[model samples]
Target: MKQVKINRLSDETSAQLQLLTIKDMMSLLCISRPKVYELMQNEGLPFMRMGRSLRFYAASVQRWLIEHEQVRG
Candidate 1:
């Protein structure tokens, strides 16, 4: 798994930190690489294009998760 050193901080502080790679997203979101790419297409997922590489803002991704969260009980 890729290394994603997220700060175990308050919500206010969480948004001030790093970006994540596709591999990192795989681990963080507990999803597959294909799923991440799907979200990038079908969903308005934020990303940064660095040459041929794709990067995502960690904070934005967390917020995306929060907004897309579903609960099943």
Candidate 2:
């Protein structure tokens, strides 16, 4: 099983911070490696580069999901 970190903050900005591996993203988004890279390139998915690695922000991704569902519906 994979693990994600939990955070507590004020009601106005209480967002959990999570670091997902490439493998974890594959499972969560149910997309292939190529697709993930495509989204990273074509779509403005929030991501950060640490050293030589890329990481996504959980809060930003959650916001993206909410927007996606709104558009879909």
TM-score of each prediction: 0.72, 0.68
Which regions of candidate 1 are displaced past 4 Å?
A: 1-15
Local accuracy of candidate 1 as per-residue lDDT tens digits, 1-73? 8998976787767664677899999998899999999999998788889899999988888788889889999
Q: Model 2 misses residue 43 by how many Å?
A: 1.1
Give the per-residue Cα lDDT of candidate 2 at 64: 72
Each candidate: how many clashes?
A: 0, 0
Residue runs of model 2 more than 4 Å from their true location after superposition: 1-15, 70-73
Top of the candidates by lDDT: 1
Q: Cα RMSDs of all predictions?
A: 9.7, 8.7
Query: Candidate 2, TM-score vs. the true structure?
Result: 0.68
Cα deviation in Å at residue 66, candidate 1?
A: 0.9
